[model samples]
Target: MTPNPTNAPARLGVQLQPQHANYTQIRDAVLRMEDLGVDVVFNWDHFFPLSGDREGLHFEAWTMLGAWAEQTERVEFGTLVNCNSYRNADLQADMARTLDHISAKGGDTGRFIFGTGSGWFERDYDEYGYEFGTVGSRLDDLAEALPRVKARWAKLNPAPTRGIPIMIGGKGEQKTLRLVAEHADIWHSFVAPGDLQHKLDVLARWGEKVGRDVSGITISNELSRGSLDDGHADALYAAGVRLFTLGLSGPHYDDTPVRHWLAWRDRKNREAGVGAAA
Candidate 1:
């Protein structure tokens, strides 16, 4: 395993689930999250509702991403984990590149990160006419698709205005971690503290085998607090888990936790001696 970094710690983020929110609400929430000091803002890619009404007001991921690019100024943006099985690899790269351009309209192109995973949600594929294959087969497809995605980015007419970060999300050790080492600029997993540590160790081993520096890849996970004193946030942070994300539902988009998380983000940044944004 590669040695762990003892440098400055990780940062915080939020996953704004777009299923429950209308376009106006999501746009407002993105602006609010930026103002609240979120380092990254994410939206999951799924056609149907993950929670609430099964037929709730839903929005497509990439198109909403274009809107997010236009609306937010400072917050980094991307899908939490776009299913690779849904779209062709080259097309995915093109969409990401286009979003990169859209987000950086005023010279901030590095604001987009393409966070993707092997497809698991069958409903998305079934309704969309995508091939819903076995998990192993899907992983195989993702493995094959990633190289083509990168190569297509290189071959695009304008190319991406910046090197848009590639984030691979999953906890499958043999395939996913190896893929992270091979292709990801960031690695996202939902494992808890102890499990997350183990996976990081595994990822480091994969990194070494692939001759890649694992430290450059940011580690991210989801977060929620029932109360302000919850120890979950601190524990994850201490474990070298930056990019903490809180999921938000809509129609009633409560800003309470969002406010608290921003406060936490500022405190962490201060402890690391990074100047708080004014």
Candidate 2:
């Protein structure tokens, strides 16, 4: 088994939930986040609002991503976890490639992270007429679709500007962790600080079984639900997490949380002898 190093520099990400906000508001928020120096900007992939009015104003994920590709110049962006049930696997790959190229300006590589997962929202499935398969079946489908997504990237005419980083979300020890070991460049989780160690241990075991090293995979945890000052961020950082994400909702997208986390990120990075934006 390869060494599982936990020395990566701290980075901050914000998930601008695409709900309760008009497109113009969303667009401005994206620009503001980039200007605020966030390392990554993410949006969730669901058709309807995950919170507030269930039928409130919301926008599509991939389309908004395309606009984000055009709007932001520096921050890497993508779905926090795109639902695999909505589109064909091959089509998803192709669309990702197109977005990759679209984001590339001047000579810079595309700042797109292909974050996805086996979807779980039953409402999305019911309203959209997709098969609301059992959890096991959905995992099976994601297991199969990932390879095709990667293969299609290789076959695309221009190809992606960079080896697009794959960020997989979830922490199921059995199937989700296994898939993360096999395919992910980053893994997003909501596990609390105390449970994070066990999750990482499970991920390591999966990596050993799959002949892959899990150390290089960035660990992403959500900050939207917790008190950042409770020493949770410090504990998570101590547990080898490098990428921290905070979810922001609208009609009023608050920047207080973002600024607080960004300040925390800078402090952590500086303590580790790394630049805040590095």
For 98-128, candidate 1 gives per-residue lDDT tens digits of 8888788566565898999997888888888
Clash tally, candidates in order: 0, 0
Candidate 2 has which clashing residue pairs, if any? none
lDDT of 2 at 136: 91
Poorly placed runs, candidate 1 (over 4 Å)? 1-6, 225-229, 275-278
Best by TM-score: 2
**CA RMSD per model (angstroms):** 2.0, 1.4
Q: Write the per-residue lDDT of candidate 2 for residues 26-77, one digit (tens) a residue.
A: 9899999999989999999998998889999999999899999998899999
Best by lDDT: 2
Candidate 1 structure, TM-score to reference? 0.93
Model 1: C-alpha RMSD to truth? Answer: 2.0
- TM-score for model 2? 0.97
TM-score for each candidate, following the candidate numbering = 0.93, 0.97
